[model samples]
Target: MSAGAPPVVTEIARPWWDALARGEVAVQSCSSCAGWVFYPRPFCPSCGGRDLAWRTVDPAATLYTWTVAEAPVSPHFAHLHRPVLAVAELGIGVRVPTTLVHADPDDVRIGMALTPVFDAGTYPGFTLLRYRPA
Candidate 1:
């Protein structure tokens, strides 16, 4: 869960954080195996390839699953009474853990189309991704 802010950026995940700051989402791809990688790493998990490339992907996904939290999962989220936590599957088959926004929690459905909402100022110097019904 790295971010643009200090103490959140890691050497292997800097590109991802930087891309999010620019309102984009970037994923790593293996040059040797042509496999997609998420959660940023130094080597390809598919084929142990050291040659990894960062590619910006379409900020669109489908709801893979979700839940409405009865209480804040963390103190940082205390302001939100009930948070719609969700895992959205991107077109490339990567599932991202994000918050479902701008919709009613009861209305969320599996396989529902979603789009990214980048919250640049929620955390100082960090950009976060959320999903909303598309």
Candidate 2:
């Protein structure tokens, strides 16, 4: 993985990627326990139920935690000179790993309200989900 690398779109995760491409967010929800699932999977991790469905969710989130990269942490991220990597917690309690965009790193804080930034064309065929202060 490197700069301009093609984003991975697996068959099982196609719905999530497609939704992002359309400027929306979609997550897998457990049909049995009503629990939410991120990082799409075939079965529900909560109830071990085989039935799962893609559900659209509000892209809004709260900043759970964040860090400003002084240098690339790994070769895979060598292109990002100084990215604000963050974990955002959605209202439904699912935490998404993303980059905080369009804000000063000094201003980023825990529990800050965040809005979705549908980053289209950055990865060629993919639209990455980023966040910014709301």
Evaluated at residue 59, the lDDT of candidate 2 is 89
**Overall lDDT per candidate, in order of appearance:** 0.86, 0.89
Tens digits of per-residue lDDT, candidate 1, 1-134, equal 32222337888988987898999999999999999998799998889999999999987999999999898776666677688999999999998899888979878899999989988767777777888999
Identify the runs in model 2 with alpha carbons over 4 angstroms from their true place: none
User: Candidate 2 residues 1-134, lDDT tens each?
Assistant: 24645677889999989999999999999989999988899898888998999999988999999999998887778877689999999988999999988879989899999999998857778889999999
Clashes of each: 0, 0
RMSD of 2: 2.0
Top candidate on lDDT is 2
| Residue 29 accuracy (lDDT) in model 1 | 93
Pick the TM-score winner. 2
